[model samples]
Target chain A: MKKLKRSARLVEMTQFLLARPHQLIPLTTFAQRYGAAKSSISEDLAIIKEVFEDEGTGELQTLAGAAGGVKYIPKMGREQALHFIEQLCEKLAEPNRILPGGYLYMSDLLGLPGLMNEAGKLFATAFAGRDIDCVMTVETKGIPLAYATGAELNLPVVLVRRDHQVTEGSAVSINYVSGSHKSLHTMSLSRRALKEKSKVLIVDDFMKAGGTIQGMVDLLAEFNAVVAGVGVLVESGEVETEQRLLRDYVSLATLRAVDAKGKEISVEPGNYFSRK
Target chain B: MKKLKRSARLVEMTQFLLARPHQLIPLTTFAQRYGAAKSSISEDLAIIKEVFEDEGTGELQTLAGAAGGVKYIPKMGREQALHFIEQLCEKLAEPNRILPGGYLYMSDLLGLPGLMNEAGKLFATAFAGRDIDCVMTVETKGIPLAYATGAELNLPVVLVRRDHQVTEGSAVSINYVSGSHKSLHTMSLSRRALKEKSKVLIVDDFMKAGGTIQGMVDLLAEFNAVVAGVGVLVESGEVETEQRLLRDYVSLATLRAVDAKGKEISVEPGNYFSRK
Candidate 1:
C-alpha cells in the first residue's frame, strides 16, 4: 500500500472499519498503513466517528492506552427501526398472505436481502451489549435470519438440524411438541457446533406456542450452554399466555390474526417497542 | 439531514454508497440531503470512487442523464480472493473435518460470517455481468450462502425444500439423485417464491456428484426460470469428471481426498483461479 492523500485515506479508513465490525484495530497499524503520524490518524478517526454518530449508522468507539484502539459497533436508531418495522408490519398484513390453516406467507419477505439485513440489524440492536458467544437457529427458514443477525453482531451462527445428518458426526437429539396441535418433533445440534457453557443468542423467523424455541433451550442444556437471549422476527400473539412454552424473548412483529376464510391478515409491531 | 463538513460528508457518502449496493442514487438526492451543490456531491463521489477502485473493494458506477445516478457494484480483487480461498482450503484440510463417509464437515466454516461474506463477494464478482434475477439454493446448508450472494448482488434468494411444507402453499417438486451413492431425493420450491421466466444464479457450499445442484436446476425448470450461473465453495476432485452431473460452475476450493482411516485430508484452490 502506498501513502495516500487525506481524502483517499479517509475513504479507505471508513470502508476498512465498516468491513470489520466489533474488532479493535490499533492506531499504529493505520498510521503505518497510510504512512502518516499517530496524531494524524487519530484526527482522521475523529472525523469518521462524528459522521457515523450523526448518521445513526453505528458507533466508532476509541479506547485510550497502549492495548486499545477503536471498534465499530453497528446499531440501528430507534426512529429508523420503528419506521422499518412499521413498513414490515404493513407488508406482513396484506390479505393475500393468509394461507390455509391460519398460516401467513412470509417466505417472500424473508427472502429479500435488504429486508433481512434490516431485520438482522434490529436484532443486533436489541441484543447489543450482551455477551453473546454465537447466534443459533433451526434449519431451513430460520437460517437466513440467523446469519443476518450473526453478520450484524460479528458472531458465528450455529444451526440446529431438524433431522440428524451423518456429516455432522456426533450429536445430541431431543423431542418436543410444536405448533398448535402439539405434534411431536425432534431437533438436534452437532456436538462440535457449540462450546460448553457458551452464552448463545437464539434467533428464529417465527415462534408459535414457543415449542421450537423451548426445544432449542432444552437441547442447549445438554451441552451446558447458557441462553443469553432469544429474538424472533414474528411471534404468534394468538397463543395463550399459559400455553406458550417460553417467555422473556424479543420479537420484531406479532401475528395477531390470520383469517383464512375471510382471506384477511393482521400484524402489528412486536413487544420490542412497548418494552423500550 | 443538516449540512456537514467536507470530511464528514466524505465519510457519510462512503457509508451511504456501501450500504445500498447495486441501487442507483441520484446526485441530486445527495446534494439535497447534504444541502450542497450537485458539483460538490460529484466531487465527493469522485473521491469515494477513487478509493473504492484503488482498494479493489468495488466500483462506483456513475450513470448520465436525468434518471442517472451512482451505483456500487461490490467486488473482491483477484489477488485478495486467491489469498482467501487458499486459506479456506487450508482450514478445510484439517483432519478433524473428515467424516466417516469421506465427507468433509464444513458447517463451522459456513457458520462464519466473515468467511461467508467473502465467498459471497467472490460469487458476486464471478457473476457480475450476468442478468441474474435471484439467487437459488437448497434447504439447510446452502441457504446462508445463497443469501450472502443475494446480498452482494442485491437479489432475492429462493430456497428449495427437501419436504414440502404446508406454509409454503402450492409448490412444484422434482426428484433427482444425489451424492456418490446416487440416492434419489425430492426438492420443491413454492410456486409463489419466484417469478416466471426469471434469471437465477445458483450457489451452494459443496458439490460432490453435483446431484443436489442438479436437483435445484431441475426444480428451476418447473418454474420456467433460466440458470444464469452456478457457484460453489468446494467441489470434490475425487469424483470422476465423467461422473459429475453439472459442468460450467465456479468453485473456490477443491477437496482432493479424505483418508478416514489415517485421519488425513487434502484440499486446494478450486478452478476459480484457473478459470481466470
Candidate 2:
C-alpha cells in the first residue's frame, strides 16, 4: 500500500471500483489507501466517474453523510446490450443448435466469461434499486449467469439443485413439471443456502414455458423469500404464446419460432427493453 | 469515442486491458481511441502497469515489433492467494459442510464470484506460460470454476458432458472410474468443443484420488490435444494418499480427513505452493 501518483492512483482506483461493483467504498478508505485528503479522493472519483459513464462501463453513485461514499453499479449501454442480444439470437438460430426437444444448445455461450459478465451486467442494471439480497438460479447452466450477476451486484448466488445432494445437508425439495417436457422434476436448496425472508433475484440461461421460474417462485415461498425479479437470457415465446405459466418477468431475448424438422428457427430481442 | 483528458484516458485504458486479459492490444488502438500520441499512451501504460504489478493485480507484458503490443495476464499475488486459500480451508472445515460419504459441500464456495475470480487468477498465474488454447471441465459442478479460469486466461471454455446430448451433434465420450467412488462415469466432449492438437488446461471443483482429472486428461487425447496443466480447488488428501491416479496437479485447499460421525474435519492449504 505505497503512496501512488495521481495517474497511478486513478488507474488503481478504476480497477478497484470495477472489481467490486455495487459495493460502497467510502472516500475515507480511498483516502487512507492513498494517504490523501478526502477532497483529493473526491476529485479522483469525479474523473473516474465521467470516464465510466462515457464508456458505458457503469454508474458511480455517491452517497452523502458519515456513511457516504461511492458505489459502482455495472451497466451496459442499451445499444450495446441490444447488439449483444442480437448476436445471441443469431447464435441460437443456427441449425446445429436445435436439440431433439426443440431446445437450443447454448451452454457454450453461457460458459464464456466475457459473455456471462456482459449479460450479468445487464441483469444487474435491470434489477438495480431492488434492494436485492442475493441472486438465485438452478444448478448447472444457470450457475455462471447467476454468479456473473451476483458479481456485478456484489451479492451472493444461491443455487437450487436438480436433485438433493447429501453434501448440502438437510434441504427443501419441490417437484414441478418442466415447461417444455411436462415431466416432473425436483429442485432442492440447502437450508443454509438462503435465509428466510430474503429478497432474491432469479436468473437463468433459458426458459421454455416459465414452469422452472414458477417452481423457483414456489420454492422461494417455502423460505418466506420475496422474488424481487426474474431474468432470463432467452424465453420460448412459442410456448408462452400457447399457454403462459408466469408473467411479469424480463427476458433479454425471445425465441420467436422453431422448425425442428427443417432446422429453421428465428430469434429476436426479448421483452427486456420493451418492458422498460 | 470522444477524446478525453489525461485522467479520463488512463481510466478507460485500465478497464480495456482488464476486460480482455492475455490479448495483445496494440498501442495504436489506445492512441487512436484517445487521439493521443503513442508516446503519451506509453507513458500512461507505464503508470498503469506499475500499479497493476504493485497491487499484484496482474502482469503487463509489452511486446515490441509490428504485430506486438501489450498483454494483461491476470495474476494474484502469492500472499493474497495464500490468504484466500486459508479462508477456503476454514470454510471447508465447517461442520455442516460434511456430507454423506465424506463429500464436502462446496457449491456455495464455487458460486461466489469474488472467491472464484481470485482462484481463477491463481490458476492463471500457475499456468502463465503454457500457451493454453482453452480451459476445459466436465458439466454441472465444474462449469463455474472452468469459466472463472477461462476468464482470467482470456480463453474459451470447453465443457465435457456427463451424458451425450443430441444438441451437441457429434461427441467423443469415454468412461472412466471416479477416483473416490470407483463408479464408472462417462464424460463426453462435443466434436466442436475443442480443436485437434490444441493445448488445454483442465480445471475442477474437487478431486478425490484424481480420477476425474485423469478422465479429462484421457478425454483430451481423443482430440489429439495436449494437456497443458491441471488445477483443482479442493483435493482429498486422505483418499489421494491411499490411491492417486494423477500426481501432477495444483490444488488450492486440501481436505486431510473428514469425520462424518463427529462432524470434525482437518483441512490445510493444498500443494499449490509446494508444487513450486
Scored by CA lDDT, what does every candidate get?
Answer: 0.90, 0.87
DockQ of all candidate complexes: 0.87, 0.67
Interface RMSD of candidate 1? Answer: 0.8
Positional deviation of residue B176's Cα in model 2 after best superposition, in angstroms: 1.7
Chain B TM-score against the true chain B, candidate 1: 0.98
Q: Which tens-of-lDDT digit does each residue in B1-276 have in candidate 2? A: 798889899999999999999899999999888999999999998999899999999999999989979999888888888888889898989888877787777867876888888888889989988888999988667777788899888888888888887767678999999877789989888887788999999999888888888989999999999999999988887873648988788999888989989999999999989987
Error of 2 at A47 (Å): 0.4
Residue B145 displacement in candidate 2 (angstroms): 1.4
Lowest-sum lDDT 10-residue window in model 1 chain A: A96-105
- Residue-by-residue lDDT tens digits, candidate 1, B77-119: 8789878998998999999998777777888998998889889
Error of 1 at B62 (Å): 1.5
Worst 10 residues of 1 chain B by lDDT: B98-107
List where candidate 1 sits over 4 angstroms from the true fold: none
